[model samples]
Structures are given as C-alpha cells and as structure tokens.
Target: MARTPADLLADALRRDAAAPLLTDYDDATGDRVELSGTTLANWVAKTANLLQDEFDVGPGSTVALALPVHWQTAAVLLAAWSCGAAVLDTATEDDGRLAEADVVLAAQDRLAPLEEQEPAELLGLSLHPLGMGMAGYAGPARDFALEVRAHGDFFAPYQPPDPADPGLLAGGVELALGDLVGTAQGLADRLGLRPGDRVLVDAGTAAEAGPVAWLLAPLAAGASLVLCRNPDPARLLQRAAAERVTATLGVQIEGIRELGRPA
Candidate 1:
C-alpha cells in the first residue's frame, strides 16, 4: 500500500503522475483548457513555491480564496494544499471575513473591497489579460500571472503531514486527513469512476452538491468533470451527450429531472 498523507494534492500527484486530471471550460469566451496530471502537478508546485517564498504560506497557515470557477482556481487550491495550508473558500464578497485570512486570493473584481482589509498579502487572478492593468488601482494587489512568471518551474514538494492532522478545512467544517483519503477511496469504489470516465456536474455554487461533487470528487477518482455553468436542461443534455458523461451530480433541478425522465 502507498503511504497516505494529510494533503490530498500530494496523494493525487503520486497516484496519477501523468494522467489527465482536470478539464475546465470557459463559457464566456468559449475557451477550454485541459491539464494533464504531470502538467497540473508542476503548476501546483510552482504556485506553492510562490506562496511559500513570497507570502510565507505553509503548515498552520490559513489562506482565503474567493475565486470563480476556472483552471487557475483549481491550481491555487491544490497549491495551498500542497503547502499544508488550510483553505477558506468563501462565496460571499465580504471584506471583513476576508480580512481574517493571512492571505487573500481573489478575482480582480473582488479585490477593491479587500484592499481595506489589510490582509498580509493579496494576489488577484484576472479573468483576462485586459484586467492586469487594473491591479495598480488596488493597493498592495499583485498580478497572479506576473508572480508565477517570476518563479522558476521547479519546487520541492513540502513534507507531508500526519494522517491525523487537518488536511482540508472549509469555513468551520474540518475534514481530517484520513477522512479525505477514505472519502476519495469511497467515491472511487462507489462510482466506479476511472481515469477515462467523464462526469457531468450540473450544479453551481448555490447547490449543496456543487464543488465537492463536481470538482473534488471527480479529481479524487482520477476522472474528468464537465461543468454546466447554467441550469438549462437542454444545454445540460447536449453537453452530457457530447461529452459522453458517465455520471452526474446535481440537485433535483430541471436538468436533473429531465435526465431521470424515461424516453
């Protein structure tokens, strides 16, 4: 048996060294990006190095992220986990709550309010290159792209924490390191999800079965996930058929209800 660590990112990197692990689609621009296991691991490592060297994010540190659903968000989340830092994922754009974080990673639009929070460090990921110029308007905000460019491509992986330590903490909810491994293993066994299987996730941030069902669960199973930005039944069905999705996670919304209907 392989060694189980507190960090899920490290476990994922070790298991699927060269497999394709993340698939992201941008509906606004119709842009699609795919990150193979190796490429994703490298990017996560580089980002982790930047966070550690520049912001001093490491074990026992807490970083808050208010990012949209995108490839960069996944990279940042994994990078934080790789460094053994707890992530605080917040959907609301409250500066007061963001201030409590040691470091804040947010989108450009959300940076202004957080400026007053006086966080230890702030990094903004622009949805597009045009937004980079706006970074100067916000005090102490740095461009995430520029920072990543300055760092070398290599990063020494941080030492893994004990299985009993906290690996992922969301708001007040804490998941033990061992529980995360068990959850991943359980998801794999229950879903019969494999490396090539495609999973469709139709819910957005509002749904109970949102990020965990769509992003984390699929990745944990070494499978690809197709995110449906909106709850359009027709579009959901079209994408499901197009992507040949094997499993789906969503509310009993219109789209999911349609899937359950017999032909």
Candidate 2:
C-alpha cells in the first residue's frame, strides 16, 4: 500500500520497530550484525542527510553504486531513495552511465579504476566492520564512513521525488520512484515472500538478482533478512537453522523452500 520507498520504510517501522529487520553474517570474518527497524532507519537517515546536504542530490541526481551486498549497502540504497535520488548500479563501467552520474560511491578496492574515469564526484567506502573510514589509502575520493557519521540522524528531502521520477536504473530496467514499492510488492508475490518470514539470501544471489529481489521485496513483504556473505557450504545448514530461516535464495536447503519457486 506504500507509494514510495520512504512510505514503505515508515510502514515497516510502524509495523514492528523492535523486530530484527536485517540480520547480516560474514563467514569470511565470522561477523554478525542484527539491526532492528529503528536502527536501520537511523543509519538511513544519516546517510540521506549526507547525500542531500553535502552533494545536493535530489530528484534528478544520479548516484552510482559500486559495492557488494552488505548492511551498509542497504542503508546507502534506502538513503538515496529517501533523498529522492536515482540510483544506478555500476556493475559495467562501459555502459556510459558513470560518465553522467552526479556522484559515485564505490568500494575502496574499486576506486582506482573509477578515478581514472573521472566522475563528477566520487566517494569510497572501506566496508569496515566497525564502519570506519578507509585505512592506509590515499585516494582523491572522499571517505564515506568518515563523513557519514557526522551527519544528523534525521533527514528531510528538499524536494520529494514525483512518482514519475526515476528511482532505480540497472542494466536495461528503469523504475519510477512511485512505482518502486509496487514493483517490490509484485516481486514478493512471485517469490512467495510472506509477512514475518525470515528469509536467507546469499551474497552472490543478491548481487545477481539486484535490489528488487534481494532487498526491496523483503521489505515490501514485511519480512526480515538473513543475509550471508561469502557463504560457506559447510556452515550453511547450521546457519539457516540458527537463524530460523523459513525461505532461501541461491542455495538448495532441503527443508526450506527456494524463493520464486512455483507452488
């Protein structure tokens, strides 16, 4: 029933702010983080403030992303939408989208190549476990972690994006800001995402499926996420059981049904 990303977030927060909205695990580092709706909203708010105040990003502004699936990536996506900015996934640099982006946010490791392209603005994320700034790297790009934490934990967009304004651009798909929630809701139906469902998603699938399937669909369906990065096959079953995962993506867990499977 939500018309926009902000509306969806507000509805979800009102539904259950104390519930775990996104639970993240990184087998590569043995790290786990659980964020309640309120906590995730706080992060979103801060990032939105950073985008709006510093970069003047709004309706027509395009924010290109070059990062993996992580908790911070969720915040960044939500923040950009909240500020009424269009997000473009920069998986292929030769697409020519990066050349026109108002700002580009990339992982520290991906900065060197992006800098050579000379985008209008570039920000680097270290993807630090503690949310710290880039370490031991001298790059022309601004540090996202160092700047984001200083922003206010609240944001108000200068101009709310119209329903017709572009919201997400990936590959050949383009969606309007107003149609985002609807698209997510439709995907939830196809994926069989149900309210309060604890869904497990692997990093590779999230990357390939894009945000519509991995992130927004879950939120739109009123479900929570158990996102695993660098998943280890040996620990897969144990982790799913521990997380109480009811549905899965990318892995064939016998007891749990795979998302998008025909009933």
Best candidate according to lDDT: 2
C-alpha RMSD (angstroms) for model 1? 4.2
RMSD for each of the candidates:
4.2, 1.4
TM-score of 1: 0.78
Q: Candidate 2, which segments miss by more than 4 Å at Cα? A: 93-95
Q: Write the per-residue lDDT of candidate 2 for residues 221-243, one digit (tens) a residue.
A: 99999999999889989988988
The pairs that clash in candidate 2 are none
Distance from true location, Cα of 159 in model 1, Å: 4.4
Give every collision pair in model 1.
Answer: none
Quote model 2's TM-score: 0.96
